[model samples]
Target: MEQSDFYELNDGAKLPAIGLGTVNIQGAKGVNSVLTAIDAGYRLIDTSTNYMNEGMVGEAIRRSTVPREELIISSKLPGAAHDYDKAITMIQESLYRLGIDYFDKYLIHWPLPMQGKYVEAWQALIDAQKFGLIKTIGVSNFLEEHLEKIIDKTGVTPATNQIERHPYFNNNEVVETNKKLGILTEAWSPFGREINDVIEHETIAKIAKKYDKTPTQVIIRWNLQNDVMPIVKSSSLKHQKANLNVFNFELTQEDIQTIDLLDKGEPGRVEGQHPNEYEEFG
Candidate 1:
């Protein structure tokens, strides 16, 4: 549980390898969950303006004894508000809502093709960082072309790229590209919502038995070994604490190879239409 056990981002910011993701967290439940996670040694709290729980997220941060310096809070800019100045204004609002003075990492939430302003929006994030309101700026759900566009336009690369990743829908190309660019690949949904249910899958179960851990531990161990930071969401106190217990054990190379076989090639349940073709965000 030492803060030293963190991944150093390409931009020089450090984040706990495992974090508490506040995606579905809401109202009082969200506040309580964040408080509990903080008490259980979680230093990273990931939220988004779109989650509509920043107020509760802010409340939990205020109530916790964890100092702002020790905590690494990250949130994203909504794609719909991608105009440069508007995005800056909205991120300032996000900071206000979270009751924090600055964010550890502020990402362009998604490259919503419908909005058609990601390059301009990315420029705004860079400008925000230069103004010292954000420590690091990055993007989520950006494919190679999108990433290339921003890099080409601004000569600045995202420090990280949050993506839909798990054993099932592992995007190898994205991972490789990000690695070469020094952009960290953060797994938004590390456990495919089915990893726990697949205890009967034999491979995971056997690995679990060998390590004297649960299937969840095996999956997390795999993520760690692969150098991918996994973000997991759980409101349950027991599960929240258990999720971070992954570092105590190690999975063998063979075990990792077997888990790799689970890749389904196709996107998992959360797959979106190609970023260029999809415009659903309003």
Candidate 2:
């Protein structure tokens, strides 16, 4: 990744602007996809304990031509491990699964707000960072209330917050909130996933036509312009390369606004799983 393609975190660690998301990527296929992504210039690999492929990610790293030190491999803590002790043990277990001494960063996978244990989860991550079990700590799927509660209660701010952002639900409020608090926002399923077809959207397609680029390229470019880094998962090597090719073009302010108008607010959520209501225990 180039210097311009890196976002320095609140804690001063750098992450690639584009990341490889390994949600369903597992086994031999998962390993090959990750290895090829590294070779294709992706430096950030995102997975989760819930994804259950930390071991495969480690194997991919070992097989990669790129040095491990040069890449940022991040995983998340699941909702099931919200208790402080459970969270700590899970972090350590994740490292063992990855076959690594310490993770570059680890995240609390979700707030699971109803359970009221995200604060405990945050405290666990803080202690894990202190114990040198992880280099950085962050959260994912945290809405405004959860974000502030964790930071206010723990007196610590996350380095990043991974959220589901796309044209249909740009999540500008949360993204702006994160920006104000010096937290980087990482977008997951930035294309709106299965519920919406971002690549074929009218405005995006129009923009792509004008630029002589694919809608995929245009959307990625728009994401970069909005300052939201997207973690795009594709098992295909060709798709990986396409995701990283957005750096060459710049989207105009008007183009960005035109795309932003596509936002359908809360209804546009890919799975309608509000962090507040979604409960994934494991």
Candidate 3:
């Protein structure tokens, strides 16, 4: 899709509806993958300190012909760096590694609720924004309770909430909560980690045939139609181009409902890490 297909965040910043996710991809391969996606018209690139490839992403951006202002670069603070000091250091490190002056968006990678420092981490993010180290700040893998804690303590609602969402695990409650709070909902594993059951589902397959698109495209379109920006990862140029080709079609109301019925709630969670119960610091 064109860069204009961006959704306005709560803070009035624009985020591209579709982004290329760089998780587990690193080195020259990662650089090439990101460059390919950018050349194919993707304007947003999502990475994180946990991904360990912000350097590669930086290299891609540096080598690309695309202007820095024309791209929306995002990275996340690691859970290990959940305190104010560590969070500040990590944000600067990400910028240094990305070879950029500021991030289009910076997110707290996870709540790490068990560690009990996410509120402080959120404060650090707010401070980074104030310093112009980041243009927008948000969270990932944060449930409603975690979100409320930060908002209540800081009076600053996140610009967006990135979560693992797919047809199998819709997480409608979180999406609705973000919507109510004017926070955009971003879907991270939009294909449910390539679960065969979801990709091979009858309803998705039928809709794919009707739209002359793959189940992957139909699913991405489903996210867009539902107002959730989807970050899809692919190392292959072919798949990268295919993923961005989804903006041309529209899913019917009945088709959307059919996909909606695929939701299995918590049982369908691919990552299986409940934010409240997960406490990993590294």
Best by TM-score: 2
After the best TM-score superposition of candidate 1, give how far the Cα of residue 44 lies from its true spot, in angstroms: 0.7
Taking all chains together, the TM-score of candidate 1 against the true structure is 0.93
Indicate whether candidate 1 or candidate 3 has the larger lDDT.
3
**lDDT of candidate 1?**
0.83
In terms of lDDT, model 2 sits at 0.88
TM-score of each: 0.93, 0.97, 0.96
Worst 10 residues of 3 by lDDT: 272-281
Which runs of model 3 end up more than 4 angstroms from their true locations?
A: 1-3, 194-196
- Candidate 3 total steric clashes: 0
- Backbone clash pairs for candidate 3 read none
- In model 2, state the lDDT of residue 196: 53
Tens-digit per-residue lDDT, 63-167, candidate 2: 888988998889999989999999999998989988888889899998998899999999999999999998989999998888889889989999999998888
Candidate 1 deviant stretches above 4 angstroms? 1-3, 194-200, 267-274, 277-282
Off by over 4 Å in 2: 1-4
lDDT of 1 by residue, 126-162 (tens): 9999988999899998999899999999999999898
lDDT of each: 0.83, 0.88, 0.89
Clashing pairs in 2: none
